[model samples]
Target: MTALPGPVSPPPRLLMGPGPISAYPSVLRAMSSELVGQYDPFMTATMTETQELYRQVWGTANEATLLVDGTSRAGIEAALISLIRPGDRVLVPVFGRFGHLLAEIAERALGEVHTIEVPWGQVFPVSAIEEAVVRVKPHLLALVQGDTSTTMLQPLEDIGALCARHGVLFYSDATASLGGNPFEADAWGLDAATAGLQKCLSGPSGSAPVTLSERAVEVIGGRRRIEAGIREEGDEDAPDFIRSNYFDLGMILDYWGPRRLNHHTEATSMLYGARECARLMLIEGRDAVMARHRLHGEAMLAGVQGLGLVVFGDVAHKMTNVVAVEIPEGVDGDAARSAMLADFGIEIGTSFGPLHGRVWRIGTMGYNARKDAVLTTLACLEAVLRRHGASVPSGGGVDAALDVYAGAGA
Candidate 1:
């Protein structure tokens, strides 16, 4: 038999891309700690603490706050599939790629999906969404809080009230904006919200933190079913069982709750990483972390513009975590990106769909959302663009970013 490869080792990289940014050191350390049994006291305590910490992160008092043992999309699916029944109407407002993902998941969940679209770079106004909700009269409104593809942040302040007025359940995927942007689940009246440990949370992407309101919990609890192996004599099943047993939130909740029923074996290491991510965020204070993102995000924006680059989309509605800039003429976009990665060990992102090949996405988020990271990316980008014969003023990018930091008293 052929011998296996040696122990794993990854190349060093300064991840300045849109997501999967560098995780915080504490989170990594937490993940490397010893493992415990699923229902052990230490393991359960860690889980409970994680839920409470995420409650602060999500700005909710939800008792159902917990982690889904998968990526951010898994959390999105769990929330949608549990809340939606066959033939129940769901309204989705699409602004970018993730919106389409939500719609597709809803359709798979047997929801009568209705979608309203705006151009990729724009977000829907309160009036427009309300108009659709009133006309469609959907049972649920599934939307993305922040779409990294277009770097647009849909405002939820008014949409929540609109959903309540029309008796529609409100749900949002906050995977990209949860830690770095301002998101108040309780104040925004969100019935359900889901997020990931990656992006602004400054951790890896396996676990997803989810919060559900009392109304949403009631809806899901109505469809609860006990697993056959663990079912008691008094257990009763709903007529229409949740389509996917693995994605069922009802049974998952029982495992998280006092009953401590066994479902799938909890992903213990991921839970530790997720817990540490939330703990660090709560320690730093949510508003402060958001302010930090704003500071560095603005620096990156100003720096790119100083390099004679034009930014894409409506800047007024841009998220504080990522920015998309137009690729200049006479520059081979792919070649410049390759040079940046190969020469500088730095990684930036490329756009998708209509914006693909037209723009480059620069992210200031998570562990990389800092003045040094932004300045380094800007300096390297300027060098890369200059090498490609693009007209970039010498020292312009770094100077402009420094000015922003100076103005912010950083």
Candidate 2:
């Protein structure tokens, strides 16, 4: 056996990249609190409080709001697998990489997946999605609210109404956009929505918060199957059992609901972090947190432009948390990113798929969405660009960002 090094002490990094962004200190502290039994009064009370807090964050009255025990994709899979039966037609509008991921997960669930596409850096219009829905006549419309890969925020306001008009169940993956952008689950008529704590919620990427409307709950509940070990006498399983037991939302609902059926032991520390994330967002006011993201995100955007770098995608429809910029001519994108990390102790991200190697994605989100973080990143980026023989105006980046902050009265 190879002997490993002693106790772990990692290098400190200012994570200014797409995600997972730096988590709030309060969230970290919450995770270190004392543990309790799953059904202990304190534990159950904390769970209930977390649900209520997320209700405010999602802007919904969904009684089914709770956290999934894994990463953001776990929530996505749970929602999709439980909602989509075999041979059901699911329509996905692909604008970015995550859209493709949604379609793939649906296919694995035995849903007949149909997809409509736009370019990587653009989003689908309501009319385009409506046109596809009319043609495909799908049972569910699975879409992404914000895809960090493209830095585009698909406008969901009218899409839900259009789906309702056509009898299509609406679901969205809001993992990258939730707290940093405006999302109204009930008002928007979303049957199901899922998000994670890593992005704008300022926590580690372990737990996924999910909310389901009454209709969505009804569909999933119809497939409920009590685990054999926990099944009581006379309990019956559905004819079409959910293929993946861990991702079964029906059984998960029973566990989270008043019945408190045992499915798996709740991840207690992650639950604490998730609860703290929602609590901090609610304490600050959801709109206020989103406005902060916008303020800092705009600063980062203006700063990059001042450095003579072109921004990617349609600016008007971009999310308020992250921005992608074209890699400068005569500069090695990877080398510059490496220097930014190795020398400056800061981190930024490179894009994927079509945008890969051509663009760098920087984020102003979560606890790092602040004037200092934005300005510091721009300052380091300017140094890296200049060292790489790219011509950049002296103090231009910081100046432009300051101008934005000044305009915002920050």
Candidate 3:
């Protein structure tokens, strides 16, 4: 066997890809701070502080707000498995791949899932969803707010109110949109919402912060914790049964509640990162952060178009942070992406479903949502495309991006 290297350093890549966006320097510093016992005074205080920080990020007053010690998918799983019963019907609007993941998780938790779908790269109309809710009369309705797979952002304003009128418990996964797009969990009538720190949150991808409404809490309360060793002695107040232990939201709530029961060991470093992510957003103010994302994202979009690549999607309904560009004929999209990463140390993404080879997804999110980052990405991308024999309009992409940046400042 060949001898392996002891350690390695990673190449610096500008992550203009789908997620795990460039991490904040301050967030990394917070993660590197000295560790303490999970329940230590300082640790607990920080944990409580993290919760408060997320409350502002989520714009909700729900008492069940807390972090799942895993990725954004963990938060989605917790919400789905907890709310879904053995035979309950769940309505999921399948607009993109992530929406299908929600239905899959709910089905795994024994939910009878019904789906209403549109073509990929498109969102379902509110009337379509309302029709499904009226037909299925589901116990819960799940949607993905911004799907990176298709670079489509669903309009939630009217859909949330429609769900309320239908008496359906509404939930959304805002992983791709939170912080970079407009989201008001409480005001939006969201029953439960979950998001990861990977996207516009500008943190590492371990912790998933979530919030749930009072009605969501009540729906979850019907099921409580089921202890392993104490199976013989069932509680008189307990429901018939509970689902998987690791994904149990009831036990998680209690642990995060006043009782503070022990669940999984809290990921200390990740908690620090999550807290800093929200703290920075709050310090900058949400509107200002959103504006920054908007400006940078638009610059990147303009730069890509200036490079002669056609933009994808209904431009009017596109999200602020990520843009999809159509792959030019005779150019291998994967080759361009590989050269960008291997040669230039810049990463972009490809689309999903019907758009697998048709478009590339580029993002300007979080720490990378800036003038320099946008210019750098465009410059590097232009070089990569030129190397593949594509005629790059000289100085076009970078010039357009710079113009957008300067105009925004002016």
- Residues 1-410, candidate 1: write the lDDT tens digits: 99999999988888898898999999999999999999899999988998899999999999999999999999999999999977789999999999999999999998899999999889999999999998999999999999999999999988888899999999999999999999999999999999898899989989999999999998787655332333445544323537887889988998899898998899999999999999888888899999999999999999999998999999999999999999999899989999999999899989888988988998999999998899999999999999998999999999999999999899
Q: Which 10 consecutive positions of candidate 1 have the poorest summed lDDT?
A: 225-234
- For residues 1-410, write the lDDT of model 3, one tens digit per residue: 99998787877889998887889999999999999987788988888888888888988888778999899999999999888767778999998899989989989988889998888778878888888999999989999999998888999988779888888899999999999999998888899999999999999999999899999887677555333323234354333445678878888887777778988778899999999999999999999999999999889888998999898877877889999998888789999999999987889998777889999999999999988888888988888888887887987999988888789883
lDDT of 2 by residue, 50-139 (tens): 999999999999999999999999999999998987778999999999999999999998899999999988888888998999999999
- Per-candidate TM equals 0.96, 0.96, 0.94
Candidate 2, residue 168: how far the Cα is off, in Å: 0.9
Query: Cα miss at 221, model 1 (Å)?
Result: 1.1
Task: Tell me the TM-score of model 2.
Answer: 0.96
Report lDDT (CA) for all predictions: 0.91, 0.93, 0.88
Backbone collisions counted per model = 0, 0, 0
| Shift of residue 232 alpha carbon in model 2, Å | 22
Candidate 3 has an lDDT of 0.88
Task: Count clashing pairs, candidate 1.
Answer: 0
Model 3 per-residue lDDT at 403 = 88
